[model samples]
Target: MSSILYEQSLSFKRPLDFVFTYLADHSHMSDWAPSVTSASKTTPGPVRVGTHFDIQMRFGLSDLSLDYHVTALEHPQYIELKGKGETFSIVERLRLEGEGDHCHLLYQIEVYYQEPVSKLVRFFSPIVKSSIKKDLVYLQKALDQQPSSWKPTLWSKMGDRLLLPGMLHFSKKGFASAKDRWIGVTEDLTGRNIVITGPTSGIGAAVARQLAKLNANLIFVCRNEKKALIFADALEVEGYPRPRIEIADISSVLEVEALAARLLEKGEPIHALINNAGALFNQRGVSAEGLELSFATLLLGPFILTERLYPLLKKAGEARVINVSSGGMYMQAIALDDMEFEKEDYNGDKAYARAKRGLVDMTELWAERWKEDGIVVHAMHPGWADTAGVSAAMPKFYDWTKTWLRSPEQGADTVTWLAASKEARETSGLFWLDRTPHTTSMIPGTRSAPRHQSLLRERLEEYSQKLSAVASQSFR
Candidate 1:
């Protein structure tokens, strides 16, 4: 056969961008494309005209390599790639329709088998059509499953190592790029019980709404009852279950303990607990109970709540504890000797960063501590989102980056993935951004010392023990 065309039409209930991005990216071409063992993009940036990829593919019983080029491209609509090997030249085209769901996809590929391979191609033609159709079905399943890891291009690697490009990835464009490689999130939470702190606003609210749509039984941890009720009502209006509101300030060890006690009494298996409640203290301050406000809210409270609720988490058999840290944490190291900012001059941002760093350290420690018990602990930063917290905490920074900032939904995406995705459960203690494992330390010496790691747990235990001795309020 001199020229053979294999074409298939596919329809999926996936967004056009979602399908289009998958088809255009070189990292995933091997995933759904038949006989491709590996594929790599040679050019940086999104797939566009003149982009180049080197491909390793299987040709019958022989190993073959091809140089592929992006010949044409259009957004969420069309893609065309042409590849040349020693004996074969191939062209693949994809066209998509519909907005975000109920999608229609057109896929076509033409292989020109020249000279030596022409005879072999003729013999394999019949089986090739059926196999191609099966691969198209596999493509739909891949889109639905949304497995997100991909080999980063050189530019993307630079984005992680460089300050400016790395920070740019925290924006909407970054989310879009990260989202492109995502396979899918197919898990449903109809019977799952998820606990989300600070769900009344910002990233937490976004996470809650997304999980609510998944039919997860959610417990909203909000400091205010009225806002919680209103948020729950909104979800109910969307036809999700009315979230069970637990009124307790996450900053209060006493309140968190009380709340944990109530959940323990309820004896429900908690599938996931999202410690998303956080604040950036501008002034050095103390909570009502005289604890350092930053430490209490960001470190101490989440620590105590996760510890006390260990039983509930273990009950679920496979549970995840997601600690929400911040990208700012990459700047600071854990201050073991001066954990409360007592010995050093207090900088609020430094304090916040330190607490987040400690939380990530704790995530590592506890993942090991609870691994035998079937509980996975993970930490994430919500990226830079246009949340009230950001506006209140860093007004000037917010103003400068507001347009580039991720929406609360984008901010919460990784956390939601961690809580609900099968892929997330495979690993624990790794810090993540954009559904990919990120370097826990961007700068030298930001990682906690082994000594500090030991002290973090010991000191937390000491605080809990000492507080229990003096705390007047009991567990809720």
Candidate 2:
């Protein structure tokens, strides 16, 4: 037999005591591991040295049922486990050290295979090492966040490792080159009521086509009734089922309210809501309500619609809400004080970028608050897509960036994946691309903790409450 050993180290802002307590509990492994589906103790008391457990794992379509015996345990310091299988033997160890307010964790894994398979496994060592390293990074991120009060499980840890990379890579590459591979395999919107804004053109139009093929009952929202009808007619001509059309200028709060009321009156739950409608004005502009155009159309409109339709979303049970964000959000910090840019110099690109960032932030907040209700909210960047909007709004920018841009269909793949895939059911409030969840680059001088997400959530909730009050007063 031949053996392979791997080691990795990660640091977290949490205290060493917290890390030790968390690691000492074997059941917490399931919370961060993507491979281990379920973990349960065979010996009924608190986990300690010599405790034994059975772990269930499913990779792709293969089932791995294994028994693990705890070998060593040193409180606030180290743990070791050994697993024996028909084909292989595995040993795992973890060590923790305290450094002020931070904790450093070290992990080591050793694997041995039977003689006949040893050589083959050695040849695949590079791949395995790479996979394990990536998994560790995800595990670190999940542990750092300390998800809302829930018993830590191995499945959660495994999910972080399995889903983060593809999402990160896709965020960088967009969907053009990877769409066909991820489309049907990752997402299926069949038999769902899918509400989409801006369904007549560009990315919106492409998404409608894909959903039609998936047999989704489509609800198309657009400002121009004639344009919406035309798009609906085209879908029918293309052998798609007739979609319901709702004509309302999303930038107008009154119109948005009426639209929500009409949908609620219909008494049918919306299985998914895609907040895809938005415009980029090269010059400063204001909506009919006297709000900044980008703010009203991109952030406020979607926020209002989502709030009004919360009941329907809850009724859908395991429903999704996808916010189409942008890569540009990374370029600038949000100006919360001047969100409307009324007092400062307002560049369209800056305004658009901030709006997208707000959307991403809100998605995370909503997911954290609503997970128990069975609702999943996700934010995603479509990469650079070659669309009419791009060409019309910034022809020069499009021309400069066209070489890397994807088709509209390509841009929509991740959005569809997050909305319809079973793999995505447990994952929410994260950014995705190419069917994988991704981590955004950290802002300079910022701690790795989810501090930005927390701040955004606070600000958004405050603003939303104000908007809700305004809405109530208007109705009266």
Candidate whose lDDT is highest: 1
Q: What TM-score, to 2 decimals, does candidate 1 have?
A: 0.71
What TM-scores do the predictions have? 0.71, 0.61
lDDT of 1 at 137: 64
lDDT of 2 by residue, 1-476 (tens): 88889998889887787677556655444434555544555664456777787776544456577778888988778988887766778898999988777989899999888878797886878866775675576567555653222222343234334544333333314232232122132123557899999889888887786677556899999998898898788767645678999998888877788799899999798899999999788799988768898888988889888877888999998789999887667656666677788987879998998788778777877888889988899988787788899889889988887776666766776676666566667678887655555554334422123676667556656755666567668878
9-128 per-residue lDDT for model 1 (tens digits): 878776776667657766455545555554666775446789898887654566689999988898878899999989889899988898647778888989888887797876887766
Residue pairs in steric clash, candidate 1? 15-100, 145-184, 146-183, 146-184, 147-183, 258-476
The TM-score leader among the candidates is 1
lDDT of each: 0.82, 0.72
